[model samples]
Target: GSRGSRGSRGSRGSRGSRGSRGSRGSRGSRRSVGHVGRVCQAGPTPSAKASSRASSRVDRGLSQ
Candidate 1:
């Protein structure tokens, strides 16, 4: 009865998209920030450091 009354939109639409978008947005922001930081700190071995930092941030993002 509840599902029928809700028309299949309430459960699927609200929960799925919100959680996915929210997590994706946070991870995207963190990755972009890390990239910008690496660019600003360009010097010797910037790629090495940036890659490691970016992976770490991704791990943290998934954990969150």
Candidate 2:
């Protein structure tokens, strides 16, 4: 009974860490998106190109 409880607790702890890592990754991506948006807003001609590149990057990220 002790061993079983320990195993379950270990699994839960690992899962929690994984969830935290995922959240951090999502936050990082959001930061990148915001930075890109700001840069895009700073110019007109480059904005269209940057937007296309950003969309492609988002697609790639989603695919992963």
Candidate 3:
């Protein structure tokens, strides 16, 4: 006479838990600029040519 007393006690302990996590996105922006300038102000003058000619004459005399 005990046929329907053990059918409702095995259906309340089978539930699983769930986990939730979030992710964040980050970005970086950087820029750099460099500038270099150079100026030259030295050249050969007429005096340099005259000195070179005199040296050449002296060398010719010595060789003679």
- Model 2 Cα shift for residue 8 (angstroms): 1.5
lDDT of 3 by residue, 12-45 (tens): 1111100100010011001101111111123333
TM of each candidate vs. truth: 0.42, 0.36, 0.31
- What digit string (tens of lDDT, one per residue) describes model 1 on residues 1-64? 8868686657655554566556665776587677666676665256546655665566456544
Global CA lDDT of candidate 2, please? 0.61
Give the root-mean-square deviation of each candidate in angstroms: 8.8, 10.3, 42.1
lDDT scores of the candidates, listed in order = 0.61, 0.61, 0.27
Task: Tell me, by TM-score, which candidate is best.
Answer: 1
lDDT of 1: 0.61
Candidate 2 lowest-lDDT run of ten: 55-64
lDDT by residue (1-64, candidate 2, tens digit) is 9999889868765665456545655775677677666776675456545754665555445543
Tell me the deviation in Å of residue 64 in model 3.
0.7
Better of 1 and 3 by TM-score: 1
Tell me the spans in candidate 3 whose CA falls farther than 4 Å from its real position.
1-44
Residues forming the 10-long window of minimal summed lDDT in candidate 1: 55-64
